[model samples]
Target: MSVLPLIFTSGWASGINAYAVVLLFGVFGATGLTDEVPEALQRPDVLIAAGVLFLCEAVADKIPYVDSLWDSVHTVIRPVAGAVVGALLAGQSGSVPELAAGAVGGSTALVSHLVKAGTRMAINTSPEPFSNVIMSTTEDLGVAGIITFAIFHPVGAAVVAGTLLVLGTVTALFLVSRIRAFLRRRAQRRAERRAGQAVGPPV
Candidate 1:
């Protein structure tokens, strides 16, 4: 079995939550659930760092606008994490070239990240904050479930991940109009605030 499938699955998961993927890989490797995980990822320091970051993300991801800000920050981090993880997996398995795996992982992660960020932007347009929390929880659960499944059945998990990536992309596209409306409303609000600020305080 090629490690590419697992790499693809991890990349997809990483876009949503890189820290969780790292933490899960470390735990699984340390516990001997999977030997495919590299020793570097299993180190205690790595696990701790990943754990802390995951917790931070868990909290920040539930907030309405905060999650979008978090996603913007991770725009670079997620793809880089995906590439590194893919290279490590490929190096361990010796089944795929490191560069090839890295390219696949990084590209997939970038696409998935864009989809997630766009969807979150659309969700943020909602007046209620519950949507953000619900979406965040769903993404977290989905990543965990898919990653765990990938450990046991890489190909199947890859298929599932790919399907999700496609669906997410489609959904984001469908929500383009809403996103535009949100942007316009936000801009109008900002302009209004600016105009109010420019006006001198009431005499």
Candidate 2:
């Protein structure tokens, strides 16, 4: 069977948390849970780096506005990670062209990343911080679950990932107005802060 399904699932997960995907895949590969993961990801240094970054993200992703800032930084990283992982998977499997797999993975990751980032922006508008923590935890669990499942049942996991991608996109679209408003308010607040600093206590 083609490795496309696994690639698709990984891409979807990568959008939300690329480091987690790498860490999990590395652990699974090192433990002999599966051989589909590329050797580069199984290296001890790679696993350690991914683990540390995953820890950083886990903390940063639970903070209200901080999560949004982190997402902004990862806009390019996530998609690129997805493409590289996909190409590596294709090379290992030899069941699909590297370019095709990379394209699929990169595009899927980009779409899902947008959905995640947009949704987080909308969530950030909430006054309480609990929502950010809840959402972040849920995303982490969802990524871990789907990646684990993909190792056992690639096509089924792909279906789940695809369904989630669609639902998330739709939800993000529904919350577009809120996200826009949030951005406006945040920008305005930053501007006000800057102005205040510039005035320097009216001196």
lDDT of each: 0.95, 0.94
Which tens-of-lDDT digit does each residue in 120-202 have in candidate 1?
98888789999999999999999999999999999999999999999999999889777788789999999999999999689
Cα error, candidate 1, residue 96 (Å) = 0.4
User: What total of clashing residue pairs does each candidate reach?
Assistant: 0, 0
Looking at model 1, which ten-residue stretch has the lowest summed lDDT? 174-183
Supply the global lDDT for candidate 1: 0.95
Clashing pairs in 2: none
Write down the TM-score for model 1. Answer: 0.90
Misplaced by over 4 Å in model 2 are 179-203
